[model samples]
Target: MFQLGKTIVSEDIIEKEFVCNLSACKGACCIEGDAGAPLEENEAKILDDIYSKVKPFLRPEGIKAIEQQGTWIKSDFGELETPLINDAECAYVIFDKKGTALCAIEEAYNKGIVDWKKPVSCHLYPVRVKDFSEFASVNYHKWEICDDACTLGKELQVPIYKFVKEALIRKFGQHWYAELEKVAEKNN
Candidate 1:
């Protein structure tokens, strides 16, 4: 790991390649996870404030889950996160006609119904951030489900950092991302 500003970033992000091959994975990350998507405290409040607008884009089961569980819930571990349906799929998960899971909140954002796209955590998949007292730990998350994505990324020659460039910028900022690029260049 190398330090960038207040973050300790893993070299795997620069070494490994990954691009979401949704056709192969079918958005399993949303529906297959045991826990709901992680959220920040502010994201919870945003969910609460925008539920009504996002509700229409959700599946019936997702809506029911959110309505019964509230916009967000404190996990048994005390982390703030989105709710789940039947303890499986995320409460905000909708699906395209092909049955690939998608975030309802993001659907709303895509339709111009809301300003927020989705939770930063959700936006930054395969790159999980753990905030500490001083620095944030940024690491690539390797999941078996995303093996196809890894293969595709390798074929496309896209590193994980490049694939998630927009999200890294969103989470860290332009200057921080630029520094990361310099570090990536040096590593390469």
Candidate 2:
């Protein structure tokens, strides 16, 4: 692991290759997870604020889940997360004509209905951040469901850090990312 500013990052983030292959995985990460996407404390308020605007883009089941669960819910571990439908797919998850899972919140953002994108946790898939008082631990999440993504990323020669650049910057800021890039360059 290496330190970039206050964040401790795992080497696997640079060593691993991963790009979401939606066609192959059909966005299983959204549907098959045991819990909804993790949310920051402030994200709950954003969900409540934008529910009406995002509702139209969501499925009935998703809408119902949100209404019943309230924008976000506390997980067993006491962390905030998006609501889930029957403890299955995320409440914010919508589907395209092809049945691939998509984020209604993001759809709203794309349409300019909301300024915020989906939760940073969802944006930074394969990279989970654990925040502490002094620093944050950033580590690559190895999930069997994303095996195809790893294969495709290897084929395309995209390292995990590069593949999730925007999200990383969004979470950690440009300076932190620039330092990470330097670390990656030196390591390579």
Candidate 3:
């Protein structure tokens, strides 16, 4: 691991490969997780503010869950997260005609109904960032559901850092991402 600004990043992000193979996993990460997608404090407020605009893009089940619970909920540990349906699938989860799970909030963003995309955690899949008092730790998340994605990424020769470049930039910044690139280059 190496330090970049305030973040301590794991080498796995530069070494491991992963690209979402949605056709194979059917976006199982959304439906099969024990908890809902993680959310930042600001994202929770954004969801509350934009629920009206994002409502139309959501599925009925998702809407029901949101109404019953709030846009976001506190986990047992007090971390914020999206609500859940039947305590299983994420409350914001939608499905394509092929039954592949998708994010309703992202659908709204794609349609220009909302400005904010889904939660940063959702956007930065397989790359979780944990903030400490002094710095943040960035690491790759491994899940069996993403095995197909790992295989596809290996075939495509795309590393995790490259695949989630936009998200890492979004969470960090252009300069931070550029430094990360230098680190990646040195490693390669």
Q: What is each predicted model's overall lDDT from 0 to 1?
A: 0.93, 0.93, 0.94
Clashing residue pairs found in predicted model 2: none
What would the TM-score be for candidate 3 when compared with the true structure?
A: 0.98
lDDT of 3 at 129: 95
lDDT, candidate 2, 100-182, per-residue tens: 99999999999999999999999999899999999999999999999999999999999999999999999999998999999
What is the alpha-carbon lDDT of model 3 when measured against the actual structure? 0.94
lDDT of 3 by residue, 1-188 (tens): 89999999999999999999999999999999789898899999999999999888788988999999999999999999999999999988889999999888899999888999889999999999998899999999999989999999999999999999999999999999999999999999
TM-score of each: 0.98, 0.98, 0.98
Positional deviation of 127 in candidate 3, in angstroms?
0.2
**Clash list (residue pairs), candidate 3:** none
Off by over 4 Å in 1: none
Candidate 3 at residue 81, lDDT?
Answer: 95
Could you give candidate 1's per-residue lDDT for residues 1-188 as a string of tens digits? 99999999999999999999999999999988789888988898898899899888988998888889999999999999889999999988888999998888898999999999999998999999999899999999999999999999999999999999999999999999999999999988
Q: Which consecutive 10 residues in model 2 have the weakest lDDT in total?
A: 31-40
